[model samples]
Each structure stands twice: as C-alpha cells, then as structure tokens.
Target chain A: MIVEVRGLKKVYGSKTGVTAVDGIDLNVADGAIYGLLGPNGAGKTTTISICTTRVLPTAGQVRIAGVDVVAEAPHARQYIGVVPQYNTLDRACTISENIFFHCLFFGFSRPAAKARTAELLEQFHLTERAEAYPAQLSGGLAQRVQIARAISHRPRVLFLDEPSAGLDPQSRIAMWDAVKGLRHQGITVVMTTHYMEEADELCDRVAIIDHGKILVEDTPAALKQSVGAQKVYELHLRDQPGRPELCARLSRIEGVSKAEQTGDGVRVLAHGADGLLSDVVSAASPFGLKDMTITEASLETVFIQLTGRDLRE
Target chain B: MYARAFAGLFLRDLYVLRRELFPFAIRVCMNPLLFLFVFTYVLPHMSGGAAMNPTAKMAGSGGGFGTVLLPGLMAVAIMFSGIAAVALPLAQEFGITREIDDRVMCPLPVWAVAAEKIVFSAMQSVIAACIVFPLAYYIPSVPVQAHVNSWPFLIVVLLLASLVAGALGLTIGTAVKPQQIGLIFGVVVVPITFLGCVYYPWAALKPIPWLQFGVLVNPIVYMSEGLRAGLTPSAHMPDWLILAMLCFFLVFLGWRGIKGFYRRVLG
Candidate 1:
C-alpha cells in the first residue's frame, strides 16, 4: 500500500465537539486512482487533509509510503502532493514562478527546479500561460497550473480535493485526462468528489462516504453490483393512468426485483434482462407503453440505494 | 536541506517584494516623510522659526528639534514597515480564503514558515530604517547633524530594533483576526507611536513619573531611545538598558508569536 489510514478520527471544537472524520480506514495501492465519493460536508476533505498531513487528526494513524504521517509529517510531505479544493495559487506570481517556487520548497536545486517546472508547464499545456499570473488565466488553466505546481517535486502520491468542482463539462474532461496521465506515470492518486459519474469514469476504486463514515468501498462496477440489480428497465407510458397498477404488475414479473413510478412511466429493476425484458414489455403493454429502454445499473442508483438520498443532496 | 528550504521561502518573499518594490517603498517612506515634514519643519516654522523652538532651547549647542526627532522618525519607519510586512499578508492568508495553506503544507516543518515571515519582516524593517535615516536628517526645516559617534553601536541598535519590530509584528499578525486588523492600527499602533518617546526623550518624561513608567511597556520606546543613544548621545536612555529591553522584547515576542503561529497552522 502506498497510502494507509487506520482508525482515523477528527473532531472540531473541544467542549461541544463535532466529529468530522469518524474512524475511517483505507489502504491505497500504488498507481491506482482511488476516490472518496460523497456530498459536500461529508468529511472527505478532512480525511484527505489528515492523510496528506495538512490537518492533524484527533486520533488515528496515517502512513504515506509506509511513513507515519503525524510522527514524521515532513518525510510524509516529501512524497505527497496536494491540489486543494480551492485555488491556493500565489496570484501575485506567474505560473512558472509558482511551479518553480513549489519545487524549491520541496528541496529541489535551482537547475532541477527550473527543468521540472518547464516540463510540467509543457505537459499541462500551460506553456503559453507561463508568464501569466493565476488571475489572468481561465478557471481550467488555473487548475492546471495548480496541478503542475503540486507535481513539480515528482511526488509519489497525489491528493486532489474536488479537482473538477465548478468546471464545465469540457474542462472537467480535460482535467480528468490530466489526472489519468499522472496515474500512467505510476503516481498513486487519491481524489474526493461528489460527482458520481466522475467517480465511475475515473476511479479504479471508490469509497462512498456519508456522515463521516464510509458506506461502502469497492470498484465502481462492484459497487453497482452491490445494489443487487443487473438491469434497469424504464417503461415510458402515454398516460399517468394505471401507473401504480402497471408498477405492481411489473414487480411480479419473473426476475424483476423492484419497480416504481418514474416521471410518466415505471422503472423496473431486474436480476437480468435476457428473458426479463420481454416480460417487462408485456406487463407494460396494457398501460400504453410509448417507449422502453433497458440499461445496466449505475453508480448513481447504487449510491441512492445505499444512502437513501441523492449524492447531490 | 532545511537551510535550503528556508532560503527558498525567504527568497520567494524577496522576489515578490522586489516586484512590488515601488509601491512598497512608497508605503515605507510616506509616513516618515509626513512626520519629518510636519513635526520637524511645519511645527517649528509655524511657531515663528527653529530659533523659538522648545527643542532648540533644550539642546543648547546641538542642532535642534530636527536632530532629536530624526532618530525617532527612523524608529517609526522601522516599526510601521515591519508590522505592515507580516500583519497585512498574514491577515489575508488566514482569512476566509486561506491562501496560506500552500505555504504551511510545504515539506518543511511548520515553524519554518513562521520563521520565514519573521526574518523577512525583519529584513524589511532594516531596509525601511536605512531609507528613512537620511530623509529624517535632511528633510527637516532646521539644519540637523545626527552625529553617529559610534558606527558599531549604531549598527547594533538598528539591527536589534528591526528584529524587535519583526517579532512584535509576528505576534500581532498571528494573534489578531482579519476583521480586527483595523483595531491593530487604532488600538495598538497609534498608542505605541504616541507613547513611544518619538517626539521627546525618555528622560524628559521624568517629570510625569506615572507616564515615564507606563510607557516602558511599549516596545517602540526602547527602539527610539536606542536610536537616540547611538545617533545623538546628548539626549538618550542608558545604552545597557536599551539593549536589555530590546533583547527581552525580541525573545519574548518571538517565543509567543512562534507558538501562536504553530497552533494556527497546525489546527
């Protein structure tokens, strides 16, 4: 494991303390994209903060590359890079200067710092903005600069807190590509985000956390499988009449585990759609099935099934 | 490795300072210039001339009010620059935005970050004093000769006074919140400047026994008196006492400030 966290707990305030991270344990493999998937205020940032040695945990042990984070934070910090949730770039300095200073802070010599900064700026396609300060760049460009700065020291482990938070779809995809490129370089990536699709698309393994506890931790496919449904069948109806009746009849179909009214139709969850799709269509025929579609279960459904709430909520 | 990290951090601050040198120089010189003009020139000229000034009457053979006020103005410049260097940046860094997160998360130990701020501010304080020294001497209405009888003692006083100012800045910077920054100027800075023996000698306050003892707690008093002792020996505090007070303030403020800084950063 490149990163290990055991029994981690953090409490804010002393007398009337609010527990931010409550006894969470995690082990991340080298070169894997691990994600903490949760809504805002779910302690993902606190957990990442503790693991990255930015914030102290009230009780627990966190080891980065086998070194105890609290006992030897400076050593731990040397091997890890963090791109915080907010843009913490030194707006007064140019992009190149920011990356150069970051490398220097990590004990890189002048020549090495300069070379690494140049390489990162080019790699992130921020070469043109090298002379521009953070304020002058677009949001995506600024985020790229922040990432370039974080990795200028060539840290083995990288922690990105909500790397795509406030970005448009195109910018988000670009950021994801940058992160994926890092994983190819053998860097262990740990990121926190509430976007379920982001977790599904990017993470090799994800932990679903809520109320300071991990509800489940597994690969995105396995997490969806844990929902105990193989296929989701949506039956769009021409009218809302007999919707409850159609849902009740659809639930009784062979291999169908659950059915509920969704929009102007009934959505049915089944163990498998090989033989169940025809049965679902037949059951919906009496209710004037306008259209029908069947798809595999997704992380969003799995998250809602496990937490009883939307990830965005 | 630690040495290199410290150098990098300090050099980064220096780079930023260099980039903003013009505005920074203006901020450092504006107050001293105004004080030098008004107290040394305007006040003396307004009340007839330097010949009728009370400070001239007190210093029978020496220059006049300008000579006495020159060192005090240097002290003021050092204090203002030193405090502004750390206090303003720290306030914004620790505000709702939390821009200092990147700095504290460096591979170096937490206290190193605080040390960098202190040392940087100390360097700026010394620079401010150097710039103000000549202006304080030449800009006054009356002819002033700030006889530096002992260059070594003068250097020592300037260095120690700047260090004390830096330490004091660190304390205020880390201790106060962003919204409370205005209070730092109104409640702390203004009071210290007025009671710091900038306009008159500490010995002259002997007649007001209560104030003489009360103003002793102000760190600027020692800096002003130390400058007086080094620059113009005719009217000044004891050399040993000035050095002792500055050293005390340096160690005490540095200790408390570093502790507070560590707490804020680690939390």
Candidate 2:
C-alpha cells in the first residue's frame, strides 16, 4: 500500500467536540484509484486533510510511501499531490509560472522546472493557456490548471476532493479523462466525492462514509452485490394498509430479497425475474398503487441499504 | 536540501516582486519624495518660509529641518514597505483569493514558510530605506547636516530597523482580518507614524512631557531615534536602548505572527 492510515481520528474541540474523523483505517494499494464515497460532512474531506498534513490528526498516523505525514510532513509532501475542493492556483502567476514555481518549491533547478512545466502544459493540454493568468481562465479551465500543477512534481499519491463539483457536464467528463490518465502514469489516486456514479465509474474500490465513520469498504460491484438485489422498485400507494404484513408478503415473493415501508411508499429489492414487475404491481395495486419507479441496484442503493438514508439527503 | 527549498521560496517572491517593480518603486519612493519636496524644498525656498517652519527653527543655527527629517522619513518608508510587502498580500491570500495553500505546501517546515515572508519583507524594507535616503539628502535648499560618527552603528541600526519593521508587518497581517485591513491603516498605521517621532526629534518632544513619555511605547520611536543617533548625531536616544527595544519588538511580533500563521494554515 502506498497510503496507510491507521486508526486516524480528528476532533475539533476537547471532550465534547465534534469528531470530524472517528478511528478510520485505510490501506490503498500502489497504482490504484480509490474513492471515499460519501455525502457532504461525512468526514471524507477531514480524512484527506489529515493525510495531506493540512490538519493534524488528534490520534493515530498516516504514512505515505513509508514516510509518516504527521512526523515529517515536509518529507511526506514530496510524494503527495493534492487538488483541494477549492482552486488553489497562484493568481499572481500565469498558468505556466504556476507549475514552474511549484517545481521550484520542490527544489527543481531552473532548467528542470521549465522543462517539466512545459511537459505538464502539453500533457494537460494547457499549452495555449500558458500565459493566461488564473483569473482570466474559466472555472473549468482553472480546475484543469490546478490538477496539472498539483502533479508537477510527479507525486506518488494524488488526492482530489470533489473533483467534479460545480462543473458542467463536458468539463466533468474532461476532468474524469484527466484523472483516468493519471492511473496510466502509475500514480495512486484517492478521491472524496458524494457522486455515486463517479465512484462506480472511476474507482476500483469505494468506501462509504457517514457521520465520520466508514460504513463499508469494497469494490463498487461487491458493495452493490452485498445489497442482495439487481433492482430497486419503489411503489407509491394511496392507502395506509397493514404495512408490516404487506412488506412480509412482498419479501416472500420468489425474486424479492427484501421489502420495507418508506415515507410515502413500499420499497422492494428484487432480482430481474421474468415476471417480477407484474408480480409487484399485482401485490401493490390493491392499496391503490399511485406510482412506481424502478432503478438498477447501484452504489446509491448500497449506501441507502447500509445507512437507511439517501446519499444526497 | 532545506536551503534549496528556502531559496526556491525566496526566488518565487523575487520573481513576483520583479514583475511588480514599477508599483513597488512608486510605493517606496512617493512618500519621501513628496515629503522632502514640500517641507525641505518648496517651503524652505518660499519667502518668510523660515519663520513659518517651526521644526527648522528648533534644529537651531545652521541645522536645516531636513537634518531631523532624514532619519525619521526613512523609518516611515521602512515600516510602510514592510507592511505593503507582507501584510497587504497576506490579507488577500487569507481572504478571497486563498492561493496561499500551494506556497504553504512547499517542502519546507511550516515555520520556514512564515520565516520566508519576514525575510522577503525585510529585504523590501531595506530597499525602501535606501530609496528614502537620497530624497532626504538632496531635497532641501540648505545642506542637511548628517554626520555619521560610526558606520557600524549606522549599518547595525538600519539592519535591525528593517527586521523589526518586517516582524511588525507579519504581526499585523496575521492579526487583522481581510475585511478590517483598510481600517488598520487608520487605527494602527497612521496613528503610530504620527506618534512615532517621524517628523521631529524625540528630544524636542521632551517639552511636551506626557506626549514624549507616551510615544515611548511606539516601536517606530525607537527606529527614528536610532537612525537619528547613527546618521545625524542629533538629540536622539542611546544606542544600547535602541538595539534592545528593536530586538524585543522583533522577537515578540515574530513569535505572535508565526503562531497565527500556523493556526491559519494548519487548522
């Protein structure tokens, strides 16, 4: 593992303080893309902050490439690349200079800094914007510049926090492509985001976090499989009938794995049996079934299954 | 390796300041230039200007008003330059722009990052003092009587004064909020300059009794008085006291500022 987090914890105050991270442990393999999938305020950002040494851990330790981040942050920084939620590109310098100065900060000679900056500009397709100031760039373009600059030193681990937040569809796709390219360069990536599709699409492994605790950690496929269904069918019915007995009946159906009553409906988790939909409709219609919505079992279903709450909510 | 990383930070500051050279020069030169032109040249050259110039009369005999102002104005330049170089940029960095992360994330210890700001600002303070010197020397119609008895004392005072000014800037930058920066000029900067003995000799303020005793708390008073003793040899404070106070202020302010910076950056 390139990144090892052992019993990591952070608290904002003493005793009665808000615990930002609560005894989290993670081991990310070298050259793999990992995701901490959670909603806002799930301690994902706090975990990343401690790993990058921006925030001190109240307990435990994080070691990146064998160097402890808390004990030798400056030494650890050489192997760490971070793209924070906010754009931290130096506004005083042009795009090229931003990368160039970053290289210098890591002790690259002037010639090496310039050459590496030029290479990164071309690699990130930012050559045309080399002379453009950060303020002159659009939000998406500035984000690209920040990512390019963060990797200027070729760090072993790259951390991205909410990489696609506030981006348009096109820019989000572009950002994803750029991140996928980093994997080919042999950099381990650990990203934090609430977007389930992003974790399903990009991460080899995903950890679902809520209220400063890791609810589960596994491959997205395994996590979805662990939910024990291929589809989730939500049936909104009009009458308030014997909800528990009705759910019991639904759960006993051949393809249905679980059934529960939600705020406005009955939720059924079922496999894609040939006649499951009609069977569900027949069972639910007596209560004046008003509407039905079907969604494939996804990382979101995995989250809702574990936490009993929607990721977005 | 630490030295190399430290140099990289210094080079970055140098590069940015070089690009801003024109504005930096204007900020450093304008105050002393205008002050010398009006007080030393324009007013002294005016008919009956001598009668109107109370500071010149106080300098007595052949000593022009420029003699007292020489050290005092240089102190002002050094202080302002320090503030401009560190505090102003810090306010913006800690505020909306928030681009300080990359700088702080450099492969140096956190205190080293804050130390770099002080060192860079101190260099600018020295440059500002140097710029202010010629303006004070050549502006007045009458010859400014600057008699330096000890070059070592003069050099030591200039170096100490520059570091002290930079430390003061760091303290202000870390203490003041970005929104409250404009107000600091009014509440802190201007008031200090006025009471700092910048326009007159400290000894001359002795007649004012309470005001003289009150201004003793101002660090700028020591700066102006130190320069006066070193460069002009007028009625200034003792050298040992000036050195001790400058060191005291430097340590106190640097400690506070670096602590604040760590809190701001490290969370």
Pick the lDDT winner: 2
Question: Candidates' lDDT values, in order?
Answer: 0.86, 0.90
Model 1 regions lying over 4 Å from their true place: A232-250, A259-267, A271-296, B51-60
Candidate 2, residue A86: Cα displacement in angstroms equals 0.6
Give a tens-digit lDDT track for model 2, residues B1-267: 778889988998999999999999899899889988888888877865462355665554577888889999999999998899888889889887778888877889999999899999989998899888888999887778788889998888888888888888888998899999899999999999999989988888878999989998899999999998888856788889999998888898889989989988886
Q: Which docking class does model 2 fall in?
A: medium
Residue A204 lDDT (model 1):
98
Q: Among these predicted structures, which one has the highest DockQ?
A: 2
TM-score of each: 0.92, 0.96
Clashes of 1: 0
